[model samples]
Target: MKMLEGKVALVTGGGQGVGQGIALALAAEGAHVAVAGRTLATLEQTCGQITQRGGRALAVTCDVMDAGDIERCVSEVVDTLGGLNILVNNAQIVPLGRILDVTDEEFGKGLDSGPVATLRLMRACYPHLKGDGAVINLASSAAVRWDASGYGHYAATKEAIRALSRGAACEWGPDGIRVNVIAPHALSPGLRGWMEACPEEAAAFVRSIPLGRVGDCEDDIGRTVAFLVSDHARYLTGATIPLDGGQAYWG
Candidate 1:
């Protein structure tokens, strides 16, 4: 039997990058997927790819900054896709600035897009997310390793998400709802753009990693997420899985 044969999933920021990868991975495993993001065009693009591969998909326009939009998108997914079994909170604002330079608004942007949006979606999906329900919150290696600078706000927000995921995992375990976080170091579109702009710096960064290579967005990060939501990981909860090729280790 397929891992996600009768499952439905909503992936935030599913328009591009890691979110698109996770959405596609879930769909390929037989889950009906809803691609949600601020841009309708990109969301449709992701959904198009899924449907083209004979998977069920829906494109939902959702701005994580807006709680109303997040709630509506969750409802839309449940209504349109039958019911939502998995939720991937993969949307975040990456603010590149020093702690001293980042303004209150800059920090707020990360919080609004990360933990706040994730909390809203979790609540919105709670009623319908029963029986093998799972949530995958995206964190970052920057936050885990704590060796990077110029992204203090972004790192803080990601850490906050980890805390939220832990709390949710503890509280919702009784309801059979599993919540976990993923810290991925993948070759996403945004990362590729950064690499192009600072080739030397990017190369140096990659060299610092023990694996000496970044992960593929779909094949690496997305597949890990797929396993987390599958019955294979039914016993897992409140875990922070680093998908960074052994770059960021908690222990």
Candidate 2:
């Protein structure tokens, strides 16, 4: 049997990159996935791919910054998918800049898009996730790196997500809900853009990895998430997993 057969999964920012890959992976494992994003066209594209793979999926338009949008998203997932079994919060506005250069507005965008949105979604899904639910929140290697540099704001938000996930894991574990964070090193859109902008730095970064290669969104990060949310990972919770191919340590 498929690992996630009959499960209903929701993936925020499911329209592109890692989010799209995750939605596809979940659907492949027999989940009824709802792909949520601000862009209907992109969300629909993800759903179409799922359909082509003989999987069930739906597209939901949502703006994570808006409380109303967040509430409506959860409701739609529940009403349309039958029930919510897994949640992967992969949406966030990544604010990049040196610590001294960041503005209040820029920092606030990171806050609202990352931890704040994550918390809101968790709260919205809490009631439905009372028994045997899994939540996978995205973090970043920037959160733990020694030289965060231009990643200060991004790291802060990601670290906040890690803390929130840990707390939620402790509070919700008794209720059969597992909460975890993943600091992925997939070749996502953002990463690709960075690589194009700074080829030398990107090449150096790739060589620094023991694996000698960047991760694939679906095959690497997405599959891990599939396993993490399955019964196989029921014993795991409150953990911040580094999916960066043996590059960084979470200390």
Candidate 3:
């Protein structure tokens, strides 16, 4: 039997990037997946891909910034898919600016989407996840850089997310809910655009990584996420896994 057969998973921001990869990986593990995002079109695209691979999937429209939408998304997934076994909080709007230059609005956006939304979703999914479930929250390698000059807002928000995950993992351990965080360095759209504009810099950056390459969205990140959420990682919780090719690892 598959590791996640008969499981139900909900991935936020599953329309694109790492979220889409994680959703596909979970489905491939025999999970019924719900890909949720603000855009139904992109969500449906992911769902189509899963269905094409002989997997079950659902497309849900959700805006993580809205508390009501978060609640609705969880309820919809539970009602439509039977129950939620996995929750991936992968949607976040990164606010880039120096600490002094980051405006209130920008900082607020980061807080609301990063830590706030993650907490809201976890709370909403708590009932269903009890007795066996996994929650994967996203952090970023850029946040821990030696020169985090213009990522103050982004780093703060992501750190808060890490703190929240640790607290939940400890508090919910008795309930059998595992909460963990992942800091990934994948070829996302933003990174791809940077590489296109500055090929030499991109090459230098890749060389700096001990593994000598950026990560694959589906193969590297998705596969690891699948393992984390599965019983294979049953003993792991409250840990931050850096999937960044040995660069900027979290100790």
Against the reference, the lDDT scores of all candidates come to 0.89, 0.93, 0.93
- Evaluate residue 152 in candidate 2 and report its C-alpha lDDT on the 0 to 100 scale: 82
TM-score of every model? 0.96, 0.98, 0.98
Question: What ranges in model 1 sit over 4 Å off?
Answer: none
Off by over 4 Å in 2: none
Report the backbone clash tally of model 1: 0
**Cα shift from native, residue 166, model 2 (Å):** 0.6
Query: Scored by Cα lDDT, where does model 3 land?
Result: 0.93
What lDDT tens digits, residue by residue, belong to model 2 across residues 73-113? 99999998899999999999989998789899999999998
State how far residue 99 of model 1 sits from its true place (Å). 1.5
* 1-251 per-residue lDDT for model 3 (tens digits): 88899999999999988999899999999999999999999999999999999999999999999999999989999999999999999999889988899899989998998999999999999999999999999998877898989987899999999999999999999999999999999887888999999999999999989999999888899999999999999999999999999999455
Ordered list by lDDT, greatest first = 3, 2, 1
Q: How high is the lDDT of residue 69 in model 2?
A: 95
Q: CA shift at 57, candidate 2, in angstroms? A: 0.5
Q: How accurate is candidate 2 locally (lDDT)?
A: 0.93
Error of 1 at 130 (Å): 2.1
lDDT of candidate 1 over 1-251, digit per residue (tens): 77899999999999998999999999989999999898999999998999999999999998999988888888888788899899999988877688799888888898898888889899899988876799999887776556667867888888889999999999999998999999888888988999999999999989878888988878888888999999999999999998887877677
